[model samples]
Target: MAVRVLAAGLAGLVAAAGLAACTPAPSGPPVAVLFPGAADDDWGASAEVLRRELADDGYAVEVRFAGDDIPRQLEQLREVLAAQPAAVVIAPVDATAIAAVLTPDAAGEVSVIAYDELILDTDQVDYFATFDHRAAGRLQAQALVDGLGLADDPDAGPFAVELLAGSGDDRGAQDAFAGAMEVLQPYLDAGRLTVPSGRTDLEQAAILRGSPATAADRVAELLAADVPLAGVLSPSDAMSGAVAEVLAAAGVEVVAPGARWSAAPLPPEGEPSATPTPPGATAPPPDATTPPHTDAAPDSAADAAHDRAAPASVVLTGGGSTLDGVRAVRNGAQTATVYEDPRELARAVASMVREVVEGAAPTVTQGATTDNGVRAVPTLLREPQLVATVEEARRVLG
Candidate 1:
């Protein structure tokens, strides 16, 4: 799996190099793509896809990376906007800080598309193309419930779980946390789940910048205090890996990734289930018609028996189907990670650019609006998938 991942990355690099080397002078309408950094695998993939797709559509595409420096990103945006390109697609380093330069007048006639991350505090952003973060959070919580067999065995446990939210400054992180809590809260109230650390609030659970060290420290502290956790709701794949490491080092048995565990059958249509619904809300439909679980355990029977006997088989759930995250899932370190396909997002943005450039309204399958502290920017939010098995990871990550 690692070899395959590496090979794919190498192929991408070669393709990018070839594209750069063979580039001709700009003869088509100019389009600028500015990203916070190329360090993130998802972002890098998105940038490459956008460049190729837009160029194929006869646009003069220029892609820039800011190395996660807010000032550098600001400078790049300013420089790009100065050219008065037909369109500018950006994923900001700091959503709030970038608003200073992404004003209506500054962007003039250029249609600004906020990619991946929303650019806040400005009304100039024309469209947003990204994943539905709140839905991702809800999926994470659902994965935990399914992994622990909580839905099927509601009376089996007041299982201890830890909550780890993302950076406070990031709106997507907050939305994810909120969405997860919405699904988990009813379980907590019904005594199906418990938090031993007593840190349930978003503010309390948030790790600044989703720092791995912070997450590791928190997990270590929990272990030191002998908090026997059955699961952890991690905001991202990076933190999930960190938390799993801490658990492993402390002698906790993490649930074997991709192992089959029986999932509770979905309730009949228009019928209520054992789980209680919050007031003024209807229960969410089952996440899948066919859950990720298999009919039989993937490992040996003895190993399955040992897992059942283990006092704490921690089920870890994460977001971002990053290479490291997929590797962890394949190796039985993390149970699952959400797959938000960057290529799909980039294609959406590319299509939007084409429509806007041709003076047509952008067509969105899932249309919504995000208020960027000035006006509600029209947005197209794509749903993400959950990856739990090596085969699933291989199929999606490829």
Candidate 2:
């Protein structure tokens, strides 16, 4: 299985050589790995991984972080292009904002791989390599379900859930929430889970650019609204931490005691026609299927809210394999986090780069292509793994 997936991942790189063979040979200049945010914990981790992996493949790689400035990143990118590298891998801060700077005309015809984030409205991108973010959301939902003992005890009262998402501009947030809602919406529909603040839209749940401060502010609003929360759908560890912090400040615990969970299997890929029936759900009748779910959570959720102990944590889930996220899972603050293997991403991107530099026609038959409002960019995607327990998080992340 692993071998097959790896081969599929390299399909685009394999084509690169053939297609670009007519072009002049790529230069001896070092390749550039650009990050939208250099100091960011998650992006930094992936950048480090890329550096090591690409170096091992004999690519002299130079990594640059675009520190919170749009023009700065563009300048840095232009500078890198000035050096005449064979290819460049970029995870842009603003997908649309960076499009003009990356024009092959301006950059002097370098092959560019859109890493992680999709670069939109342009034909400059050669390939898009990222994990199935929607799968990340599904994993988050499943982990939350398991952590709350919903699947373990169907009789367990429906839990109150708060939904949060990544950047609104990001396709990842769209896909993640869409996928999460696919698994969780039924529960919302079936009276198994809910959002107390009634904020279901990805926009309402968004944490700008995965900003912790934005998440904290939203969480504060939820607290001010006096809504009870038993579970939260956090897209990344940073947002999870922010949510956790505000709850702590409000004198609420971050992890419920005596909580136990086992990982649940995910639904099949390619968006299964019919997702597995949410645990404890019943097939609706042909008529009279609507339940007046006026309130977000049921009576039990309110009960849990009213009789909270001095310190009690809520069930939470996130994605990414950043150091903080891994430690949170290990320490039990986060019930689970989906780890989209960065090593695989690096390997595939590196392979794609090498092929492009060799002037090959890289064809990617694997993974889905996302239409970036202009053209469909071929993608290489990997599935993320759920890390629930301290032991599990440590084993995988350490």
Candidate 3:
């Protein structure tokens, strides 16, 4: 019965995505990249890197935001393809629905590279550049293992773990869960970790369900649950922040998988200068490693504005330099995060686009395909490093 119910749910989701599943990639510019969300969002930071690098390499790059709307994104892609660029780069907001449209017929005219987020039709996309998200999950689990010293003493029975998945529509979130599970399975098999019911929280769904408060409430509920949790598999630093607030307020020592940027691992950090604010309002205390925030009520645009205006420190993470996610890891803020140098990725894509435009075939390393509704796609996967802590960040940041 349970299996049937799950299948039905999946089918229903697919059914609702009728036109979305079969759409194909359209021909477009030498390099047209779509940003599915706001440019300033952390996830969008990667797009910026790609844009800057591609521009530096003398490529014409057109960037557009999808504004969190799938239909709008599709329309944008159609328009972009009409321009007939050599290739189109995309970070899809909804992989499944977007996959419906990424047909080779749409993409056959151009080379496509699915950035960070994996797009469905593999045959159409010539290259894929992203972090080894699965490995990131393993790193998060490993961090919990080390933090709890599970390896040293195997007798730690039944530590609880909650999975705060990113948007349900995000493939990275799904992959991160898989990666985390790979590391956690051993502990689960040994009865060393216990995942409680209602532990799998999806942020976007919560919003869609009109329960934005559920995120914090759920974390609080989990912490207060009878079973004790050793940690949580948080897909992003933002989620970790919410979980942290609840745990901190409850005086519970909770663990979560956080990204390198939020987990600045250093101490006595070089504090950046703060912009002067109104005399009545005082500056929030600096986290030294994490982004700043204002303690204001929800829906307070003024408060949100205040938080954004604060001068933030530049912590190194998410890219493979010699530095890893050092600051966040040392500060116990992040467990692990993906690091893919967009400079390298952009250069590769630029070259691939050029090849596609010149009617030259792109070289493929490891051939693989992801199923778009109509067909399978040929793909080249890029490797990404998962980093944790100040030392690791320092090692990579260099």
Candidate 4:
């Protein structure tokens, strides 16, 4: 019996040695990428890109989709936490609601990043990687005003404008509305643009998740009143087409985002500075042949030569590459859509992961901090582009 016991112990020791010898030193740890909704359109594209980038950076990546199910997302997150991944990039289905599961207690040392949408009411989020949503909102509103020729013509006269806000749960939606209002409030205050439907408030105008069905139903209600809508502030590409369809059915002329663009130098920001302003508002024509009389730069001779040589080109601008947005621009249903490049966002997330894992500061172009109910979360904002025309769309999206 003693001899038998000794042989069994020796066998167990040999098995343990074999297992240890085969086990390679841990180089990279498992990383879980969780999305509140299924990888669909821009969100999906971003997730896939992040996954690929993470793998390239030497991490085992796993992606899980919530299919827009809140409970399911919470469960998936719980499961991910249980596995003790090295890090996670979570796009919450409900920013405020997911706070319970994403708390520091739940995450332990696992770093958590809020993707695109800001996770509100929580201090547990370690970082944020997304585009400038407020800027996007501003861009969307600017497109509508430009398409309607309202910027130049305040006497474009009390034209009816209907505003649409994205889903209520989305903080980005609120930011977009805020940004749009920044430019539009002046016009609205001056009686140039009016909301006949009285659905001007962000909460009142929002369609959940910018769903097409919701937009169609709500827009149909607005159309029933027979009040002409010179412009509609669409919250997103997903809802833009449905809203446009309703408008077209009612016989309203639709100017797709890229329908009319001039071969002019891109303005610094905001709406094109040189526009046909409402009669009272003084603005220069885009193609005023005479140069401004302001004192020229120090290198006036060289600058003038460079300026004359620099040919102006029509810039394609818009936010996302969603099929609806692309098709709308192609069909001239809506003006331009903001092209918040998912690749850039993906790269940001990958870079963030690299930094957080290594205990280094993530590179942020803008050191902006947003309060997510609990504490101000450090954020990185990616610059978004405006995609103007079909040809531009092909190049940008492809």
Q: Which candidate leads in lDDT?
A: 1
lDDT order of candidates, best first? 1, 2, 4, 3
Tens-digit per-residue lDDT, 1-398, candidate 1: 99999999999999999987787555778999998667355677779989898888678999999876999999999999998999999998888998889877889999999888899988888888878889999989988888878777756677778899999878889889999988999999998889888889988999999998898898777665555567889979889888888877766667766652422345799975443322222444533543544354425433333223223468888888356777777777788888787788888888899999999999764548887888888889899988877788777656
Query: How well does candidate 2 score on lDDT at residue 20?
Result: 72
- Winner on lDDT between 2 and 4 is 2
lDDT of 2 by residue, 276-318 (tens): 2222223333223335433333244433334332213467787
lDDT of 4 by residue, 232-330 (tens): 677677676676666556544455445432323456878544422221123333234445665445354333333331111111223454555766676
Instruction: Note the clash tally of each candidate.
Output: 0, 17, 44, 24
Q: How accurate is candidate 3 locally (lDDT)?
A: 0.56
Between candidates 2 and 3, which one is better according to TM-score?
2
User: What is the lDDT, from 0 to 100, of the residue 145 in candidate 4?
Assistant: 69
What does candidate 1 score on TM? 0.79
Off by over 4 Å in 1: 1-26, 39-42, 258-310, 365-367
Better of 3 and 4 by lDDT: 4
TM-score against truth, every candidate: 0.79, 0.73, 0.63, 0.73
Angstrom error of the Cα, residue 171, model 3: value is 2.6
Clashes of 2: 17
What would the TM-score be for candidate 3 when compared with the true structure? 0.63
lDDT values for all models:
0.80, 0.74, 0.56, 0.70
What is residue 289's positional error in candidate 4, in angstroms? 55
